[model samples]
Target: MSKFNRPDARAAVSSPVKTKSRASGRTYEGAPGHARDAKSELFLLAVANMVSEDTFYERAKDRDDRFTSLIHKLAVEDADWTARLLGWLRNGAHMRSASLVGAAEYVKARLNAAGTRERRTHEAGEGPGAAAFGGDSLAYRTTTNRRVIDSVLQRADEPGEMLAYWTSKYGRNIPKPVKRGVADAVGRLYTERNLLKYDTDSKGFRFGDVVDLVHPVAGSHSEAWREWQGELFRYALDRRHNRGTVPNPDLLPMLAYNLAFLESAGENPECLLDTDALKRAGLTWENALSLAGSKVDKKALWEAMIPSMGYMALLRNLRNFDQAGVSDEVAEQVAARLADPEQVEKSRQFPFRFLAAYNAAPSLRWSWALEKALNASLSNVPTLPGRTLILVDRSGSMFGAISQRSGLNRADSAAIFGTALAIRAASADLVEFGTSHRPVRFSAGSSVLSTLKEFTSMGGTNTAEAVRANYRRHDRVVIVTDEQAWSGYHGADPLGQVPANVPVYTWNLAGHQYGHGPSGESQRHTFGGLTDAAFRMIPLLEVGQNATWPF
Candidate 1:
């Protein structure tokens, strides 16, 4: 085969985002930029956006307003598509606050549309309410709104969380669609264990509050199950008022046991429950520690609580474990779970979380385990054949925290993901760019965390110059950036230096309204998220398949 005609030499052409020609815009840094269609813009922003959290270039309210506006537009234009995006945002992309906020706006827009239709029909003398609105289409919209609301409420606490958002944002006039959707979710999510774990005083909307508002009935289930749920709901309500009575031991023995233990523990602060007793009572670490008070040894308490700790709880408390002087044996157990592939998958934690934990931990003991966990979390990142050019943006605008509480920033996220891709690829060139650019050298099998230490905060985003400087004859180019490229002497495009034939992937970490380059076209693609799942699109595109929205 001729060198140019070879299969590997040909550029992989695919459309990862389906939108029209990009329009002209400007970056937050005042660079000439390209604007994406509403759907494309919303998808990119929703994935990385922590609703109400500010980026370096955008304030919290501004970003949140943009997000809500896009969702509101799309929610009415294409309800099915919008619904799918909201569901995936919560479950697949693992964006919690954004999904919750999106779901609320989605329903609000749909309901407003429905209301408008009803008003028009009544004004035309069609009838009243459902009759005036035309029942079939109205029912469909209602069902869709309800499903979208329920889809995002995956966790037990999310029902209450969604309620809080809806009430706070849209106010006390909670629509039936929101209430019914929450009720459906409550039926599925509410459980004795969840009540014990999340039904606490700290949350504004407790389990009892949700039940009171939604009045959820146990959906179609066995009679025994319904009876048990009824008792559970009533108990939740009572618990909020400090008048909860223990359930019949036969129907809810576990809850009864836990409730009895809590009551007894309240009476005797110095009582130390054994591990077996704690497990049997289903006592969470927080409850256990609170019940044991200051009398119990920290190390002993953590050791006993380790067995019952969820994956996230364990990951968060690794520092606490080290501080408490947990024994090496207990540490090994925690490490085993942390590194377990099944446990990691079930945790549904973002890859950045492992990085955050790794950074926060004080001991070297957790270094190896965290490394493995990080790798496991990024299992979707492909090991591409041939050479690849990876650019990570470490500009000033990339320094904002991903969430208000997160210590990690978009820069750290870009480096972590870009480094991981480089380390995993067969042959790669890793570079970090800001005002200037330089190659980040790392030997094969180097730790992602260790290689990250070599990267520093570069002053500005000279994306065009960086790509021009680093564009060798590579098979593909992946730039992990906020896409806030600085306008060169004449506002040069970042990926313009690379030939249009070769594939260029823009991993947008900031979800800015404007992009550094045109996307949704052949050989130019854009993806955004805090997870490695989007990396799977590369291999798909390489094999002559069009990558569609991940739902």
Candidate 2:
């Protein structure tokens, strides 16, 4: 067979994104750029976007404005598509703020469109308020808006959060669709345990506030259950206003126990609650520690909290556990939970979170457990059949914090993912690049967390040079970056040097508007998210299948 005509050489091309477009913009660093269609752009941006948080090249307000604009446009253009995206953004992608913001904007835009249509019909002298009050079109739109809003408000606290975002941004005027959607969510989400866990004074819109505004009835349940829910709602209102005497111990056991605990703890700050007592009272670690005050024994408190703490809480407090000198026995129990695959999956933790925990944890005891958890979380990162080149962008711009409150930045996130890919692949060469490129050394079964230490922040994004210098005859290429690559000396695209027959996957960490190379078709593709879920598309594309939207 001719060299170019061999089975490997003549690999088939697959289109991941079907949209048609040409390179139409410049990257932040002046590389030739490709523009994605509205849907593609929004998908990439929404998955990676930490709402109201600044990126290296984009301001917080500007990024947020762009996100809202895209959502508003898409919400009006294709309501069903936009609704699915919003739903998946929250439930599937685990983006809380973005989904809430998107749902709010989605309903607002659709409502505005309905209002415009009604005005136009009224002006045409069709009938007075006929389009607004009696049209099937309006009804359909309302149903869609309500469903989208309900879809995003999955957490018990989210209905209140949605209302808070809406009132803060759009004002006190809560539309019927928004109210009905929130009401639907409240019925499903509200419970005694949820009230105890989430109805805190820190939130602007509390459970009581949501119940008052939306007036949600009990969800599908027996008459007795519905009556109990009514009592729960009333108790929530009374508790919020500091006028509640006591919740019924039989119906709202958790709330009743928590209230009793708070009163007892307030009366006697020095009295140390036993682990079983704390567990029964459903005291969160924060409240437990606060209540303990100067009499607090860190080790005793942490041990008590460990059993009741959720997986995420346990993962985050490893450093605290170590600092508190938690016993080896207690540490083993924590490690067991951390290393449990079931627990990791149930937590819905982002892969980068394990990295954060690993970095924060001071004790080496957690290293192996964290490694196991990290690998489990990255189950979506496929093991390719042949050699792979993994490029991690360590550019200056990639160092911006993912969220204002988070210490983990895009640089760390990229490194974690790139390293995980390198470690998991059958045969892989990992490279870190910015102004220059070099192979990152790792033997077989290298630790992803350990390999992260070798990466440093380089000055600029010389992506084209990196790919040109490092493109061996590998089966595929995976570049983890913000896509803000500068033009090479000859102004070449970053992936231009690689042959089109060999697939190139861009794992975008920062969702800049313009990509460094053309993607969404052929062997070249782009995907973005804090999770490794997007990596699942590579195997599908390699097998000559089109990779559709994740949702």
Candidate 3:
């Protein structure tokens, strides 16, 4: 039997008997299986740190047949374990975890009683009367709103029932995005269940319900915008019920309205949008061209549409319009904008945005634009006052997809963040570690995309050697990885070699419960997420201040 009472925890180090067997150096239950036990510990470490609940369950189920019972026991009696699991599910969305609904349902099913759930300590925040929903405060409402919506969606079977669940559980705290998601989900469900006939009469699908659900705050930027959107949704539903055809571009949400109008106009909707109507509908020039149907003057429209898109949005969507009427002049203009260092400095997008673009673009034609974006992204990276060293793990496990849908692996994500940090730091050295440590160099005028393409992924996970070899006099050390390092030559203890005065922060791409590297939970820390906000915490930690979750 294992020494620890908890079935899910790591195996204990001590042997059941102090005496060693003659046949083998160590014996357990009269067997020579200590090596196997060591392997199992490594496996457990990997399972514990999976990105989220769904991933944890997937890996556990694949690794052990008895995992169902083990998870049930953990859910029912292990409060700390349950909270940690829930935290992974709740917060992992920004990091690209599977559905929150699925995670909640899994937890609820294994609870002591049916439909019974409780909030955990870290999520509830420490204070008197910090209830799960936290009454009417906006901050508290946002904290629990996403969770409540996912839970309600999982529980309710019908749109009407979903509306009732929303009314009772969410009350006034319902988020606008939650409303849109629910409407779309329920619409699909209704079609599958032959319940679409009941939609017209329901308030949830019509104007009144949409308004009530998304009553935007009085002075917010989108208050008037949301009101106009509500009008369009109402009009569409009303016209659908009455078998009407015309779709007004000024009142409708761009995509759906554009499609409907195109259909009504024999797939040849008018080339021009009513300027007043577009303004009233909060439409962008890009919105007007989204349904241009491939027949419009691509160059003239592109030039005229110059003022319609934001710099970031323009950069993001440039490749999408490559086949359209993009003239050489237009491409040149865009390239010039990209090369402006000032434009790069002003862009709010994180380094990963540029990396993603660099990864997806097809040819040298887009290289200049991508290079500029990379430079701009690096400008946003905060400068560290002291020396910093960054280690990015390129082990095999880091090649797993960041999200099932993103098509981006954890290795690229690590490289993107790691390289950006290195470029931005006033004084820093960057390296990649897999079988062993190696310095990652960027050639002069090299873009993040090009650097990543040329960077080779090594096979083994000699993480300890990487850190130990790179441990110079750096004041701060940042290691980016999935944290699945195997037993290295130096015994998997990279953090142990660092001097006491230096701070080591591990950014866990996969939300695994255990770290192959060390984290002190204080000055030395580990954070999990896809956002650049995690970088903001380093300066705070350097100044000896406690940093709260960036969300």
lDDT of each: 0.86, 0.85, 0.51
Give the per-residue lDDT of model 1 (tens digit) for 1-551: 47677654544455655433554778877777788889988998999898878788888899899999999899888888999999999999989889989999999988787778877877887866575555545435588888888989989999999989888877888998899999999999998888878888899999989999999987458898898899888888888877847677786777888767777777864444467767767788888877777877888888888988899999888889998999999899999999999999889988888888988894888988889999999999999999999999999988888887878898998998999999989999999999998999897789998999999889998998988888899999999999888886356667777887788999998788888777766678898899998899999888777888998
Runs of candidate 3 with Cα error greater than 4 angstroms are: 1-233, 239-242, 245-317, 320-325, 332-350, 362-380, 443-450, 490-492, 521-523
Could you give the C-alpha RMSD of every candidate to the true structure, in order shown? Answer: 2.5, 2.3, 12.1
Which predicted model would earn the best lDDT? 1
- lDDT by residue (1-551, candidate 2, tens digit) is 48566776544555444334467888888877888888878988899898988899999899889899999899888878889999999888889999999999998887787778777877877865544455446435588888889999888999998998999988999998999999999989998878877998899998989989998987468888888898888988888888946999987787788777788878875444477778777777888887888776778878877888889899889999998999999999999999999999889888888888988994789999999999998889888889999999999999998888778898898988898888878999899999988888887778888888888878899998888888889999999999998887488868879987888899888777888777777678888899988989998888877788888
Tell me the TM-score of each prediction against the true structure: 0.94, 0.95, 0.58
Clashes of each: 0, 0, 6
Is 2 or 3 the stronger prediction by TM-score? Answer: 2
Model 2 deviation from the true structure expressed as Cα RMSD, one decimal place: 2.3
User: Which of the two, 1 or 2, has more TM-score?
Assistant: 2
